[model samples]
Target: MAVTRQLTGIQVRGLLGRFDHEIIFPESDEFIILHGPNGVGKTMLLELIQSLSGTLRIPSIHRTPFSEVRLTYSDGTQFEVSKALQETLPLGEELEKQIQRLIFRLRLPDGQEISSTAGFDSEELASPRFRDWASRVLDLEPVGPDIWLTTGGYTISSLELLHKYSDRLPTRALRTGGGKVDARILAFLGENEVHLIETQRLLTLEDPDSSEFRRGSTRTPAVSKVESFARDLTRRLADALAENSRTSQELDRTYPRRVLQAHTEYPSEEKIRERYSEQNELRKSLSAISLLDENVGRIEIPKKMEPWQRNVLWTYLEDTEKKLSTFSEILAKVSLLQEIVNTRFLYKRLEIDRRRGLRLVSEEGTELGLSMLSSGEQHELVLLYDLLFNVQPGALVLIDEPEISLHVSWQKRFIEDLQRISRLVKFRSVVATHSPQIAGKWINRMVSLGPGTTD
Candidate 1:
């Protein structure tokens, strides 16, 4: 059974230019689309949601001194996260007056609230009375005017200490929300439930079953973009290949055992030799084909030749190319047979080779590498693959631009294809596109963002 989780609404103030929008998602399976021009806060809105979900760090691009975000989940759970900069006190009366402070607050579910404040004044941060207060509230003993807890503890200046505390204060508050509620919120905000597919083509050529993918290396940036999906697919494919290899070995062993039994029952040395010779010949033919197939992409015709000779060369090259194309198409069809069935695209094959990486083959057996694909085809393949394989059911997928490289015809079918894929995967999506063709007939779900608009 698929888990159902939804973001009902969000309210923001002083964050990325005062965005205040209530996104009431459809109770049905329909997804939302944020249509707007460039420079609007569409991507910022997605980042804010991602931050609220605790999956990403708060963007440093926010120039505002204070910001607040409130989120309402489908389960009636609510969260409000706020951050305020430390103010400066008047120079003359600073010692006599209360110091200015930076404040961080979080209002969790069940009406419970947690708040933390850090003073800006150096004297206040060093004072024994203030140290006692910190000890009581934050459980840290002051070792020196600039250090806290034990001698081996963090040895930072007063200002840096305050800043560090303020930065992590929200996470601390989350910890205090009662174990069950805290766990639930963390799970809800986890990467598995919230996916953000940024607009960048990051790919690297390496073995899929290599240690890099298995141990989750950061050297591959594209892997991080689709981390969970890549990890899961890598494991599944590696296991499947290993199992198939084992089955083949088992069959080979069984064949010898069967032959030995047959020989004991009715032995014939000439018959055995003839059978072995035939099998050897078959294996040699297969080996030759495999070697030729591996080098198909490198095959090139000579430039300097007579017309008739060139024609002959062209015929040979064309036949070889046809065989290679058919081989690629067969591989693709076998790999993505199920996906092809669901989407019904003219693309018959989608292959993620251990060595070659991703490739697409048309129904007519035209094979193309990822780089060789047209812009529209690349966009369609990347988006569809991410939606179908990466995103989990009931999760919110934030797509930046679905129509960037799509043709008008493809743009028109974009929403329809997305809707079909979403239904099959049981996930929800919020797409940000500028093309009306991409928005299609889902205008009811569209929220347009314009210049100087709060919502």
Candidate 2:
């Protein structure tokens, strides 16, 4: 398998046909804060980067209003995307002509370039199958050849809808813009891993299998992401427990033979005691998260024991160590999440429950539902959960308007929290925010996006 490249820099010219911007991430620091005022394409730039990243549609790159975009990777290679200027097509143009209206070129790292007439076919967009997909994924009505009516009483064009709802469409749907050029572009950029957390971080899809989000429909269902993630964590803990059970059963079945044949030299009593202390502390940590039984307490080892007794105890400790290692990854993530969120919450405590996934408790010992959290609290929880759980190691995370719904104090702590998360999870992050508190003292990490400037 080919290795995916890590994005190290971004360059865009004529963003919105007025502003130019460049950002180069520091080698040592994983955080890049994009500091700029509104309408300067801060969010649009993130969108373009994400769209160019392999996880999104290839044709959408041409739809963005940038003269050109160049992404530099850690391997000293660059991928450049640019659009060939064209006159606006008149209304009522033929579908075939419209399919080839906008031309886009993707320049590869090796000095080779490929081009595609970047537009989807109207017939394809108007097909019964496509309409069914749109209905299922977005709950939009296909009203015409290139027009869709939303539940909000608003009509959207095919390209606009495709760009706006790109995340909702499946890969196969986006693949309808078929061409050899698109295939090459997709192949070249497909190795990159990228994730985007939009400003509206609190809303989540009610249906797991469908992307049916209706902006203004009373019938559209929505769920609090905090509640949703709690359920997800519950399932993860259940899986880990099941795996641990299997491992314990296998080890127990061979315990007798291992204990009987133990002629190996045992560690000194002091060393044995130290290992016991360490393991005991580990058990207690996991127990706090419900990964282990709450009966775990500091264990006291006897100073004197027969050789056989010592060997049996050593064997048990070894087995216990193996069993507890099952929760190592989960423990690190949950612990960090708790540390960050609990510190910011004024009177509430966050706990992990084996059956409930995430449990929020009041200071007076009252259990709080996910809905009880204020919008700021919910945003903090949802964003942290996504960064810790949904994103993979070495992937690039794009966070837009992270200060939204956050207090000034929480905003100030945001960068520090990200720094801690980066140390544990190992991913590059690009934060776009208007809050000076969000930047705090990270002046070296700030990338200001403005007119005719590079940072």
Candidate 3:
């Protein structure tokens, strides 16, 4: 994974014209939990962060009323997004008008600051030209005001629709009209990936085209995403095997030549046997996970061997090591997923099957359907899968209300499990929760957002 900049802290003022928050993330901590009373703007702060950090959603940003927001990054760069509030918005069509008063400013570590007035063309969004083009070209069916049914049968908001079709749309449609200056700023913000896992944990949170939503479920079953993920994992394993096969064949074709060119000096038989033993153990691990089809049969190693025999054995082991290295990352992810999930499951165990990617088998020897899992179980599986597979390295993951539908015990273990995952996945997390159990023992890492308080 490529290294990218991460958010170090965020400051917001005049949130809903009353709440102010300044959240500074711990430099070394894997995650930060925001806790406070209801209606204190915790979730709104997260949404503000999401809208400004990545893939700018103009409508959503406007929907979230705020005076000013400043985001500081690990690289010492900063972004300040503010808007002019002329009048209080009323409900109905009158509120849909574009204020066109947003200002975006980017400040670099070197002290250079670039600013632009960024706003979307509301006319284009409401125009029949764009609507007809979207429906005809993109296959998006207009289901409600500012809502469209994606080809997959799931609904998407107009803000998301504009984002999905931004590249192919007209230049003046959503661009800030600041020409190259705004374009550069948008591109810069786009580089910093930010994912928001909202309070709607049961529904699919990502775009419509994601593997989970592509199954054409109008009302997306949360468990279907898990099942689709299993199938996707199987495909990924097959691709990895194919990659290993290609690499092995190429190595084998040149095996004799490479061995012939090798030096005569060889390691001691004990050392050679040790390396062979390590490689065999790796094979066993892979086979146990169904990543490898062939069994790892026991090998008889001679206590003593000729120099030529040692040379051949060492070469073979090196080749085998290269072949197995392909699965190293994939194996770690799958193993961790299994370990965490199986430990939490009460009566079932998760097992990887080459044919099905993964399966839950009950103690009674019956295979359980992915959809049969309870809501809390589905939340655990889906959330973990997204964090492990969907999110990119160095991205900011904002999880809202992670304790929803989760058992109190599970909530207590949430932070520990997330910390373990963060260590392996190297990303920053900012979670908003109303439950004290989810906050756990990390008192120093908790930022309490209260009415009119800035912390």
Candidate 4:
């Protein structure tokens, strides 16, 4: 079941520096977003909060175990962790700025100290009590390299930041390896796993067609069949029937987790080999789908937006075109590689060819179709991949001025569709945009940040 998150608060310390203005806070949600114009300290705000956990610069913190920090969270909480630096012991330490650790002291319901100053390094390391409230509260983790940070003289690129600290990206991630799975497909698998595990146990019991799994006395399926049965029977439950079956099966397989314990050694030899081969095939298709998906997110651009966006998109698309043109006979195969950017007449030989056509009237028509695809065709495939990619969990999509390179209709319609799909797929998008219409789609999550914002 989809769960709601609490609006618990966080106190940030070791900030490179606190924001001069108060940072806003929302009561509850699985994720939080921040955005703003250049120099508004959008990056700074994310860094400050990220520091509260771990993932960015430590030694360059604005404050430290060393004291005094700015707060960007809410106005309500039973108690907050307050502390003063032990200044007296730093007679000659040069006031270290690096924060090696961020320790959060929690006040228990029984008014007891959960720790005697002995704390864990990360949130996961924190005691069970703290995790129950904090883990689900923040749920922030690094999705991949698209992390954006400006702390410690570092420029975090699109492949460097994640809202949550999970290794879910193509790089080195946990249990989920880089198998060419688009982010969305990966998420679908996870949701399926959650539902399938339980459905297996009960579905087999309800329809015990195979006597191989019958229990000694009861009509229960065999231990090994439990897992397979759930996966099979759950697969049988389609969209509408899924909910009904999931509900009933959930009750039947209430002890699904416990069932996993029965298979002491894991999957049988035959099934293990079968899975290995199946996984290889899945990865090949997944890679192609992911490559095409990056373009779909491009559809979010608004019709009436800023100029920098159009300029960026134009330059990028033009550059790619020039390179590909060199391989074939495109417009006498313009020598883009030989052209100079600052030349007075860079486009001296350029002509508006919006009405251009590719003529291939022969058995080689199939070959011509491959060589002369229109820009619009490329854009559509990109959008398709983007649509598929959003179904994955913990995706951090960094879209820079997403309002360019396509029709206005695609921009509007895809915005609404993308938002709905992203949520179901476990994605957290951070876009640098100027379109109010695009921003409106993600209104509840808007966190504008950039330079000129104080810290």
Candidate 5:
């Protein structure tokens, strides 16, 4: 039997000064179409489900500050979540602390009230099934830290947490082997891959599958390889310097003043020469100089880093490993992200080749490869890339406005493709568009965003 999560009704509280609000989700279709103009809280409604399910959340940018997030279903199953948002006070005062704190609350069907991160205990919150829902699905994840939460689904926030269970991971551990935990999480949330985009993106807590490598290198991380090279370089430089310093001081009175490195035998030879010197003054100076230089040589940094600097890699690796292994879904996203990056790379290659074939590549080379293609073709390629980011099946997608850059024919075709993509990946989708052409050619079931009425 096909797994389905029927949305009967929902209630939200502590959000945008809304103590409580009830939304009756359309029951006929598997997707929920939240219609609204620019300012309405259609996106906010979508984020609520994500927060409750441990999926990522797209924080509100406009008005209606999302303070509390709560939801309820037809069967009275509900989820309560609390969020804390506010800047901290410079001065330390207990009473002023509350001013800097914002909290959200959600009530689930079982009467369980969830507040902020502190409100839910990890022991009670960790569920193997949530891990499952997020695995193998695609369609929702943030392009950057600007959007919090990594899982993708409805509202660019809600995780159509995959309810389906498979043997890819263990039922209790919910992870394959800690190597792909992040990918596993993506699979459950209806997205099974992730991509790291933008030039000079931070390597902090980033996955290793990013396809944008240093042109041609092994899949090994750029940072790791560079670090190794630096270490070897440091050692070689230090050795060469030390050898020169020792040879310089081994001369007689008329000997040309030059530095020489201390060979392994230099320590014993220097003792013998000092005993036979006319005065101990020159001998003491030479020995002292050699000692000072040797100490400096000892201070030389590793080829890649200083000891202090290298320590960061250790700490970062430890923390990343601990946090990453807990979520098996992340592995799936990392795999998919690699594919997305490769696609972008291919697009770039195609553009470069097209431009070199004799055309004005100056004023027109805005986005490199993207500039060579027609707008429609570019949009289609971009859509495919976006779709690949969420490669897992059985996901629920809510699209606010899909006709932004599409044409009349593309609107219809894209909608059909969107429908087809869901079937291939096992997902459910809802789209909102203002294009009358799309409306005429496509869907008939649309929930209007006009003023409220008891329809």
Candidate 6:
């Protein structure tokens, strides 16, 4: 079953330098724009919110000690996660190594809390309070020092005191208003629903023949960008052609050789009689292959093309053409190629040649490489393609600095274009930008982040 989950809001405390205590209001609009001046930690706050979903793992050095994040879902359920750094005693001058630990607590509507802590001492699992808490919340009765807790379909064995729930509870009790508790927990952990677009979103398309063709600081080859949509279209076309070839092979194998000989020239009565017998034998073989009676002769081995067969073949060809046309239509709809072609005379059409990569044909019959496009145009194309083809529906998309490389006019229409694209893709987007032109008239949907801001 597909569940519709939306992030209502998030509260962070003592996480980063700027965000001592911050409350982000993301529920105001499906599309959110976070705009602020430089050094305000706008990008850091975005990263921290993304990390809280549990999809991204922060490095130990980047991880802050004594940080708490509370995320509220649309269903009123809350996920509260906190991390702390613990240090042991040192012998002399050298300090002891610090261990970072995490804790998870699920808050229900009835005021009940399901809590578990990781990185605790192994001996602590033997404590009576820990066992009682496990039995009540995790539904586990610990018999020994080592125990496992089964929650939300996954087994939690990190704590030695945790044990799997022995009794099977009612299905209704296990599920919250939205869905299963496990699914909610997984959703909070950024399972398949979070998409993070970093500030450095530009893709470098390096020309193999000339190093001067490379643009940007990155010198990555062209294969990375080409693999995105071009490869998928190629694979689909290959599969379709393979299917057609298989069908042709099947027809050839089932065709009778005697019928071919009879049709090669005008047949005499004797020759016709002999071919008729061969045809009967051929029918028998085909009947056996098709699991039908010999007399049925359902598999027609035509000596010559009939009018009805010609019509059928033409219809099949038309259907194949329609399949290819449909693919082109989908590509045109999802990408900005058609819009670019319609407005700008830069290209007349966009096509993919098997020998060459993506090609743009101009009005003057000139084939232009993708690398020939300006940086702004390339950024626009790549961003649209990634949004349309890469991200899934209902995903929380976090884009950093969308106005980079875009013209002032394009920046003004950025939110509008995003809104139109969202109609087809159906994703919740939170874009961080410094340009007021990008925000435009959507100021009501905008959230401002300031330095040393607290909730």
Best by TM-score: 2
The residue-by-residue lDDT of candidate 5 on 1-455, one tens digit each, is: 33344445555554456435555556455444444444445555554454334333222211234555444444454444344544322222321332222243444445664443221111211343322233322212433312213443333211111111111112232221223323323333232111212112112122322212122222334442222322333343344335444543332222322122222322233333333232233223323212222122112223455344434333333332333233223223223433332343333322111112211122434444324555444444444434533334444455545565565666665555565555445555555555555555434455554345223
How many angstroms is residue 410 displaced in model 3 relative to the true structure, after the best TM-score fit? Answer: 1.4
Q: What is the lDDT of residue 394 in candidate 5?
A: 43
Ranking of predictions according to TM-score: 2, 3, 6, 1, 5, 4
Worst 10 residues of 5 by lDDT: 159-168
Candidate 6 lDDT over 253-365, as tens digits, reads: 64444233323234343443454465556445323223224574223435665544544433333333333333342443434544642353344555544333245677788
Write down the TM-score of every candidate: 0.53, 0.85, 0.83, 0.30, 0.38, 0.57
Per-residue alpha-carbon lDDT of model 3 for 1-455, expressed as tens digits?
36456688899998988988888985576789898888889888988888886676665676676889999888899999887633212222534544535778899889999888755566666777666667765689887676789878898877666546644455445536444337768888888888888776655433333111122323333436677788778887898889888999999999999888768588789888899888888887798788775454345677779888888888888888898998887788888889989988889998888779878899898999887889899888878877887777778899999988888998999988887777788788999998889987878888988763333
lDDT of each: 0.52, 0.77, 0.77, 0.32, 0.36, 0.54
The alpha-carbon lDDT assigned to residue 416 of candidate 1 equals 77
Off by over 4 Å in 1: 1-3, 54-66, 85-110, 114-188, 202-235, 241-357, 361-367, 451-455
RMSD in angstroms, candidate 1? 15.3
How far in Å is the alpha carbon of 99 misplaced in model 1?
16
Q: Model 1: per-residue lDDT, tens digit, 321-407?
A: 333333342233223433542254355555454433344567777885445555555556666767776676677788888777767
> How many collisions between residues are there in candidate 2?
0
Error of 3 at 226 (Å): 1.6
Q: Which of 3 and 4 is the better model by TM-score?
A: 3
lDDT of 6 at 210: 19
Better of 2 and 4 by lDDT: 2
Candidate 6 Cα errors over 4 Å, as ranges = 20-28, 54-66, 88-99, 108-112, 117-184, 187-192, 204-329, 332-337, 340-349, 352-357, 451-455
Clashing pairs in 6: 147-162, 148-162, 148-163, 148-164
